[model samples]
Target: MTKPNLLPRSSDMASETSAEFSWPPLESNPEVFTEYLYQLGLPSDWFVGEVFGLDDDSLGFVPRPAVAVIVTFESLKKETDAVAAAKVDFFMKQSPKLDYACGVIACIHSVLNSLDSITLVENSILEKYYRATKTQSPADRATTLENMTEFQEVHTSYASLGQSSVPTAEDDVKHHFVTFVQNALGQLIELDGLKKGPVVVNAASSDILKDTAAVIQARIEAGVYSDSLAVLTLAKVADDIDAAVQALIDSSNGVLEVTSVENKDGAKVSRIKCTATGHEMPPRADIVTAHVNSKRFKKATEWYSYDFAQFEPYIVSHRRKPKCLFCNVTGIVLNKIPSEVEKHMQGRKFVRMKEHVKFFDEAEIDKDD
Candidate 1:
């Protein structure tokens, strides 16, 4: 328009400046192109710089097109921070052929790799933190989660029994079954992690028969027990209880084995064996019954009551040191008592006397007072 100016326009001038600083064409030599990008602030880790020279064809014709080499470098970093820098290097290799779509796919792949690295690092951090603060064993934590989930399911299933106008024997059996299964599963999970062995659910506890059947059914669904796994029932081995054994066999597809044992009431107990073998075995129960009971009832009775007919001597020997029982105990120690030995056992501490005495006289009391 008014005799077009020979001088370049502003856009053309800007383009010339950009062209001067532009990355070298990859067709000339990919290494030169990569180095140019690196000089332009591209990260060193973005591309693999190894040179694989041209290959030979038939009759030793060395004419294989130079192939760009890519090597992976992994670093733990936030996904958002790494994507943009990764994308620039990826597109540089593809720009000569105008393979924009390929370049985009490569960038996306890099982003996914970065995200996966972050996720793995996060899980590892959580695992380390959990070990640092948690007092429970790793097996305990794993079993706790397993038990809690199972307990919640059972609790939800039994809630309807609460509102029933007439509670029947069937309901009682079901409730007992639920409790038995919950306990058994908890024990099994713990044992599974510790023993690294299969939990052989000894069906000797008649209270657990119905529950065992339900457990077997559930395990079948979870793939813990299958047709190959052994399921032994005492009923099957005994002539009088074959029907009970058959009932369980009919309920599950697992292999059945039976044995007999005497029940608490003098009746023969039917034992069903659900042996979990191999790496697939579930955990065993935490069999801390006697220890747990001792801890639970320790503080309920005074020092005299603790020196029972069976354990009196041991108690005396343990308390002779004028030890601070509470501090030594597995439980929290509140105060130090010079005479009685206080120690934590299974989250509870107990104070037991060094020697039994009928009474504290006025002189002893007066000295302390």
Candidate 2:
């Protein structure tokens, strides 16, 4: 959806900029959107996986039983007209209650409302929000969502992360996020919070993945998205895979055979083989702890810790191209080995960064450097 029209005139810009209620613009990254779901009490494994393409092969990247797909694209003129034409009566009739962040929230609600098979933990924000508004119209639900302080707080928190070190006054009015999911009726529906209501795309299908893929592919070919640039992704609202694996180990009544599997990197990882279900999985942290505590597995190697005495204040980088957080510069190789870390620590650039971190601290260094 578009940014809220809080500052329509130049005179109002000053007041709107100072206003606390103005929705901070968020990044279009799936990670940010996924974190918003986590803040709403979803598990860590219920993640947003980005789809690189709209073809059938692209579906492989997405985890199965995907509750929703959020696609962000540069809206084309004809595509915009198509969306306006296909607007449902329910949402079209009502005025837009939800403000700028409606697209993200709408996708969240659409997934929770439609996917009953996916279990949301009891008393979760997703569960509670769904139950409280299950009977209301989509428009009414949007109205309720617009006023929720908790959601606004969570949305604002992530949006702040998208803010750059250099604040800009110009607003980019190109990218928009829209969600796609199979509604309770088994029809693939497009839920754009900016739109009046859910837009019906197709009827019930055995494979919603292929159905959704086809729809997305058509849009890409129709010039709605410049190939590969169109952001298409599937965010599954499901249980944590790690948590599920743990549950299996806890409940297994079969012979628990513990073995050390040699990983590709020559590391000996603990493997738990359960005879009951013939399932084999890597041991969870707690399971490994139990084994170590009970002396089932004894440590042979000496415990060594990296001491970055000369390193700067860098937490860690998650981006594709990692950088030195202390230096505020990119291209620093992410060498996890202690020796490599120590070597990087002794570098002149890092030493200079250490001085800056000591003087200004991490936040100020990020801002001022």
- For each candidate in turn, the TM-score is 0.13, 0.53
Backbone clashes in candidate 2 total 1
Query: Could you give candidate 2's per-residue lDDT for residues 1-369 as a string of tens digits?
Result: 998743122222223223344455456655566666667766544456555555665555355666666666676644553542233222311223334454466446444644554556556666555555555676656655555555566766787664463122345546666667765567777776666567778876456667777877787778776453434344443233355345544653334555566643365565676442234444443323333334222221111123333344453533453222222332365543445565666778777765655345588878986
- The sequence of per-residue lDDT tens digits that candidate 1 reaches over residues 1-369 is 589544322233233233222111122222333333233222323321221221122112111111121211111221222211111111112222112112122222232223212221222322232322244443333322222322223223332332443333233221100011112222211011112222334323333333344454555566544422222111111223334345544543442234455533365544444321101100111111111134422333233234322323223233433322223222233322223332321222233432232445689999998
Clashes of each: 26, 1
**Cα lDDT, all candidates:** 0.27, 0.52
Query: What local lDDT score does residue 140 receive in model 2, on the 0 to 100 scale?
Result: 57
Model 1 residue runs over 4 Å out of place are: 1-24, 28-30, 45-47, 51-369
In model 2, which residue pairs have backbone atoms overlapping below 3 Å? 91-196
Identify the leading candidate in terms of lDDT: 2
RMSD of each: 31.3, 16.0
Error of model 2, residue 126, in angstroms: 3.0
- Please estimate how well model 1 matches the true structure, expressed as its whole-model Cα lDDT: 0.27
10 residues in a row with least lDDT, candidate 2: 296-305
